[model samples]
Target: MKRFVQARAAAFRGAIGAALLPLVLGGCATTGINKGQINVISTADEVKMGQEMSAEVAKQYTIYNNAAVTAYVQGVGNKIVQHCDRQDIEYHFAVINKNEVNAFAIPGGYIYVYTELMRDADDEAELAAVIAHEVGHVAARHSTERMTAMYGYQFVASLVLGQNPNACAKLVTDMAATGGFLKYSRKDEHEADELGAKYLYAAGYDPRGMVDLLNKLKGLETTEPTKFDTWFMTHPATSERLARVETEIAGFAKLTSPVRNAAAYAKIKAQLPK
Candidate 1:
């Protein structure tokens, strides 16, 4: 009887392995933004990481509180998100009270823009371009990919798989200190710019807005170095980015009469603390 039971258990184990073979093979196949990339981090973990990092950022900076301005930013962000490819994830947008002319996106969909960046935008389209660029970063899973590359995939996987909140928080915070979350490689930036323009065009916003913002930042790189420093200090806008964005804009020529929404942007700009 014991020998019969042992044989049955062995057969069961083999059957289980056979059943799981297809699943294992499917998991190995690449899809979406993770295609051709070595991303071991799962989607749920990416959202958790963004939530933790976003909370940390909120603790460090004051969230801007102007009702109308906040609403306007959210409106623009929402529109771009609707046209984005990664609709499976929820997106969060906020304006920080800092005067820095910069914006960043964490894994998942946490995107933040500084007040001065919004205030400095030439129009609603420019602001949308900035938000869309960050969205592109999130949509592309750049941060998760970056972390996977920086820290080995196994190391990142362990924190997420451990299912410990504190461990996940600590891992994200440590990455923040290393400037891992703050900067993207120039290749990443180019990808973001191109993707941002594609989103802008899809959302009926002129893709030229991206080109305009890049030009504005490049021109500011010399004249008002200090003010521009707020943005360039962490995220450097290079000549290559400008050229790349311009080329991207050119591709959208067939997109007819994209909305610039200048007057509405002026009204939102007026609400900012002067």
Candidate 2:
């Protein structure tokens, strides 16, 4: 009886794998950012998917209730949004009330930054750099690609694009917060940094802001490990990442007068809760 049950289980597993093979192959689609890269979800579907995930994230994290701080973050995010590739959808920027230094982007244009990250920035440009980095992820569709690759394109397509189901949103929330689901690959991180620097410069903010913020993060890794853990946990920091930002900044041939806007940054930072 035991042997018979084992055989049946093995056969079931094989059948499941065989059934999924065609869907996985058929679901593969090319990315808009790079023709060589494949993505499963379409632009419209990705937006709806992100909205659902954002709603779930909101349930987990508290939205900072300050109007002034939220407005400032939105203002900076909007500037970078103008320089992003996906301009069709409106970007939503919100501040989490948490004191942790962190920020992340959902598949669509939704981005959240912790108030601590805002308070820690040296200038408006640094804050813009963080927001721009998240924008880079959305523009490159890294989150969507990551999801499809991890859970087969067909499954993801059925969940997000096919039906506006709660199951897809729940899966996204679980994966994003816990497992390494939403965590970007090293290549993805580098690409985001590159695009972010370009957007930073294009938006009239110094691309060096990216480097400066990274340096600060590296410093915090030593002095305030717990505080930095929120960011470093998902977006691991390395010397390579820091060097890449510097290299990107160096590549800029003719840089305009990039705005650091120290005064504006100070005013905004002051608005955060004590």
Q: Given candidate 1, what's the lDDT at residue 262? A: 95
Report the number of the highest-lDDT candidate. 2
- For candidate 2, give the lDDT of residue 94: 92
User: Cα deviation of 93 in candidate 1 (Å)?
Assistant: 0.6
> What are the Cα lDDT values of the candidates?
0.72, 0.76
Each model's Cα RMSD: 11.7, 6.3
TM-score of 1: 0.80
Error of 2 at 29 (Å): 4.2
Listed in order, each prediction's TM-score against the native is 0.80, 0.85
lDDT of 1 by residue, 42-130 (tens): 67877776777777777656788788988898899999999887877899888877655678787779888877777778898899999
Give lDDT tens digits, candidate 2, residues 16-126.
Answer: 565456755787654446656656577888887778777777776788878888898999999999987767677999988776778888777888888888877999999
Sliding window of 10 residues with minimal summed lDDT for model 2: 1-10
